[model samples]
Target: MYQYDAIDHQLVAERVAQFRDQTERFLNKELSEQEFLPLRLQNGLYVQRYAPMLRVAIPYGMLSSNQLRTLADISRRYDRGYGHFSTRQNLQFNWPKLEDVPDILAELAEVEMHAIQTSGNCIRNTTTDQYSGVIADEIVDPRPYCELIRQWSTFHPEYAFLPRKFKIAVNANENADRAATQVHDIGLHIKKNAAGEIGFKVIVGGGLGRTPMVGVTISDFIPRADLLTYLEAIVRVYNQHGRRDNKYKARIKILVKALGIDEFRLRVEEEWKHIKNNESTVPAAEFDRLQSFFTEPEYQTLTDNPSNLTEKLADSTGFSRWFERNTFPHKKAGYRIVTLTLKKAGQAPGDATAEQMEKAADLADKYSFNELRVSHEQNLVLADVQQDQLVDLWNDCKEAGFATPTLGLLTDMICCPGGDFCALANAKSIPIAEQIQAEFDNLDYLYDIGELDLNISGCMNACGHHHVGNIGILGVDKKGEEFYQVSIGGASGHDASIGKILGPSFAQEEISRVIRKLVDVYVSQRTAEEHFIDTYRRIGITQFKEAVYAKAN
Candidate 1:
């Protein structure tokens, strides 16, 4: 993790002080709630259903042990002894008092973290592969580039007040764990050309809302040095033309739709003429400075040791199951990447208790370097765990409620804290997720149907990324009655596409059955080795739709 220098420290401290004053003014009745809306939102404070929720940004999902400890402390002191980890890899406290937020920001500043840019119509948190630096297939570490963007976008004078919120993602691997280069406002995929020049494949105009659109490629190759400049061009174009009349119609996707992708590309190209290589252009020295922050840790050189772990797995079925599902190949010779699952059966999808947070921090220090990563899937990552220690780590995690090994499976769902916490939600999402998990408790069945994304949102805001899930369940209100709308075949990776809705909504009681029927259809129709997505694409949603709804009719 990058240590904050004096300037970095001071910047956060100043922002905290400013927000403190603003919050005090609002509480004192010097400013109206309407007047304080943007300011509070910019600081990541939201007025939710029960109380104000304060979201704290964890840049690129990277964290130090100290930072994790800070989060644990914040949860213990300011919240209800827990914090909700969001799909964007941020943390939200659902019950923080409005007056306590500035104090929270000040505490976060001490650990080189903040809540700035976690919300409001500005460049939000930049997410990359949780395994970016440690993954074997990565082209290069994506965090340096993410850090560069973080610097360029933080309180950027021109982009501070955009027409709507904008999001960007960076992906360096073909695996797409970051879901980078997806349907973001701007997506960048890092690659090295045949000539050995590093550049990005730029995609623009992708988003998920009432209308979902996959981002279309706008530039084939944007050189590494000009990344910031190119990004500025994209945001500038959106800022200039994105609608302002209606908040719902102000996102870049609407602009992208109105202009057509070809024209949008041309317009961005025209705008790039003036800013392609200007002061905002990332200098080689600056890149070097940022890269220094993300240099690989001193890793021990060890011979391949797959024997003991293989033998252990062959003996203990429980260990074998966990090892197969929770581990990924690490870049180092004898290391592995491990995900600490927070989605145990019946737990809220991303809520980590203070004890769990502390335990995670302690384990990160013991098993890996004192470095940890919060994944966009709302889980924690131990990026450099040794292969030999996998069982030991798993045991510890199991004891601490961190070892479920259900990554990318049916139970590893992405769900928003809907009606219970969010003021905008029309229905409850956490219970739906819980019901689905209970219905699909068979681990072997889940592993058989691999790599399926299940996302749920209480409303059309798509916070759960329902539009991009292989199975998207959206909550809707029909005359004050809670109903769930199901969608199928959505993807958020390289070939990002939004799911199509299946007929009418179902009553809350029917949601789990509908999901079961949809899964059953996929299971019955899939060819050999076909995943849920592969089967869905081949058979389309019609068969699954009929299977789920026909019985009800």
Candidate 2:
């Protein structure tokens, strides 16, 4: 995690003071709601269906134990006793009182946190691979570059109000893209040239929400020095040429679709000539300074699978299952990346209670070098844990209800708050997610299903990233009734592709049955050890579609 310097601290504190005044003036009736609309949004305040919701930015999803404790305290005091971790890797408090939001902001500022630019039509949080530096195959640490983008884009006057909200994500790993870069407005895939110089393969005009698109590569590789200038050129072209009359078609993706990537690239290249080698170019010293913050944590020199690890795995099936499902190989020896699943029975997906947060913070302090990462999949990551402590950590997590051993399984679905909290949702998402989770509760069944990404969005907004799920479920409002539209064969990684819709929508009640049918189609036909996505691709959508609709009929 990047420690907040004096500048960072001052900036957040000042923003909090500014928003406090704005919020107070609005409440006094001196400022109208229309007048305060953008102001509030810029501070990450949203008037949800039921109550005000506040999104606090966790830049690149990095959080310290102290910060986590603060968030837990805030959840307990200002809002409900839990917070929803969104797909963007930010935490959302769904039930915060509008009047108390400024105080919330003030409290957050005390801990080097704020909600500035989390909302509004600016470049939102620049997300990246949750396992960036820790992942062995990653080309370089992307978090430093992510922080660079954060410093460059935050309160950028030029982009504060684009045609629509814009998002940028960077991925450093060449083997797999855990960051879902292909779906971002500007997806920066870091690569090295023949001479071993780091650069980016820039992908532009990709997003989900109404119009889902896979980003087209605009530049195969641009030097690291020109990153910000190139990024500015792209955003500048979008700001000037992007649609403003209709927000639905205002995204850069729509513009690129209209102009074609070729024409868009031509214009971006034309615009880049003037500002390409200006002050925006990253200074070597500055880059080094940012990189300095993300140095590897001190690790004890221990052997892999240290004392009792294999013995415990052999002894306890639960431990073995968790070891397989919840843990990942760390870049360092004797360390493992443990993901704590937030999806469990009877609770809404992506939500962590205040007590859970505090417990997680404590666990982070003990196990993960006082650092925790919030995954894009809405789970918590302890990036560095000694191999020997695996069982102890597993037991602690299991007691806390985050040890479901279903990281990439069907029950470990990514779901939005949907109609439960969000005003724009077409139908309820939590219930359906719960329903699917309950149906797939059996560990044996889940393990058999194998490596499925199930994502649910309450609407076309695609907050849950429904388009990229191996099995995607989207809520559609059909003549005032709630229904679900299912899709198959979508993925976010190397073979990034949007899911193809199955057939006509099904009622909420039939969702579990529908999912079961899809699962059956895969299970009955899959070759040995094939993942659900591979099976879907091998069999094609025809079989799954046939089975789902045939059973429905």
Among these predicted structures, which one has the highest TM-score?
2
Writing each residue's lDDT as its tens digit, candidate 1 over 93-143 gives 999888888888988898899999898988999988888888878899989
In model 2, pairs of residues that clash are none
Task: Pick out the ten consecutive residues of candidate 1 with the lowest summed lDDT.
Answer: 174-183
Total clashes for model 1:
0
Q: What C-alpha lDDT do the candidate models reach, one value each?
A: 0.88, 0.92
